[model samples]
Target: MHFDLVDLRLFIQIAESPSMTQGARKAFMSPAAASARIKNLEESLASRLLYRDSRGVELTPAGQLFLQHARVIMRQVDYMKNEFTEYGAEASGHIRIFANTTAATEFLPEILAGFLAQRPGVTVDLQERLSRDIVRGVMDGSTDIGIIAGPIKADGLQVIHFSTDQLIVITPLEHPLAQRKKIKLTETLSYPHIGLHEGTTLLRFLNEQVALSGQTLNMRIQVYSFEAMCRMVEAGVGLAIIPESSARRHQQTMGLKIIELDEPWRVRERSILVRDLEALPAVIRALISIFLTHDSARERRS
Candidate 1:
């Protein structure tokens, strides 16, 4: 049977709220108008779609079955609009992305600059959050894409290897370890170490490495943001083992000395995550291509 989009929309709204009055408010129609529309829909389908009671309204079996099909139809309708809306240079859209502090502060600026240069009409909304939050945002559809450090196990998300980064031990310029090219992981335990919170990906990696070696890291301070960690290290509060990208960014400002870790736990892979690659918008796909290609070139150089 043929149904207008408006009828389907009203049906979904009624199914969602159940109360005709509440559904009318949501659909921005008067109660009488909304009721008339719903009655017309039921008449057209020749089915009892809702059962009214003293408390509110409930969907009949026919309504429940119709709601499922209505949802799919609405989704397809939305997809069609989005597909055509972002079609060309004149067609504009917004992309929302989530990233951890290191990637947000270090990596995304250049990429965004290039993207905006190419697509001036498009807008990007970036949220800087912890790795776990970034992953959650991607899974929940709150963000279009996420850039994070490894060891996340999220089902249905496509994880692409974008870049590999090393962790560096940083101290104030005049600190004892400054003179050393590389310091043993064991040596760090002797000194106060400023670290990210236990929940962060970096801290999780560090803890795993320490546990694997049958040792534990001695954390002097636990902070949420990398900028805070760098500031603390520069103030001589303690040395910190932070992502190399973060250390590179703050090296000049903090006058921090960065030394490589001696053994196995130094390197890490950074990844880009998307809920579904095939479902991503063209703008996001373009950004992903740029990120992967740029990182590949950098890898070839190294």
Candidate 2:
């Protein structure tokens, strides 16, 4: 009825390896000891967890179920250890943030630099995720905060206005589309496009929109960064959809024309979402405060 972490860890290792000997070696235990520990674990559970043969070992159905729970337990243990390890230091805690494409790429770098500079003890784990996924991560306690763009329904979470990010198309100055002031996404799909590389949050979102429009994007080239994509577009390669901030900055130097997107969804209001604002640690609250202060300053100027 009672099982220890060591027994569970060893069982997981054994299940992953081709043989108990290899698993024992990885676990830093002798094969005999490993075998005995596993035997005791199976006896306690009253189930045959593995099948042994001359070649290797295979997990039984019960073992498969046990392995899933064991992995989850170990992961939570590690996460807990990491979360509290710095609490003994001065004003420190780990914060996990999930942000969408625009927030992660265009907004957070400068803000995070200042935040981290002031508090050396605090650490942030920031990850880029789709907005819907970021919302789920915040609600499920996987992420402490979420920054998302567009109007995604967050029924119960606390929401704060972060910034406004608008998507616009950029084309070479002499291109046919450059003559126009505005256009729809569907209209641009017929033309060759320069896009961000696969797996970017922005590209994924755009692809989803393309699918919903019942059309496919004709991507001529895919690059890693907005700067690169702009360069490609300026070379008459293809048109590109980029953030308005980036398009404005690049337009000053690059020979590109900014064309407004006529669709209503093109202008996205980015927001910060959190499960609870009052319950957050001081460090996270400070970070959120910085976000709001900067956003407010920008709004006032605009």
Residue pairs with clashing backbones, model 2: none
**lDDT, each prediction:** 0.79, 0.84
Candidate 2 overall Cα lDDT vs. reference? 0.84
- The digit string of per-residue lDDT tens for model 2 on 1-302 reads 87898988898899889999999999999999999998998999999999989998999999987886776565455445544655532246677899976677767988998888877777889998887889887765667899988888988899988778799999999888889988999989989999987877789878989999989999999987788988999999999998998888788899999999988889888889987787665677888999989888876886
Q: Which candidate number would show the highest lDDT if scored against the true structure? A: 2
- RMSD of every prediction: 6.6, 5.3
Q: TM-scores of all models?
A: 0.65, 0.72
Candidate 2 matches the true fold with a TM-score of: 0.72
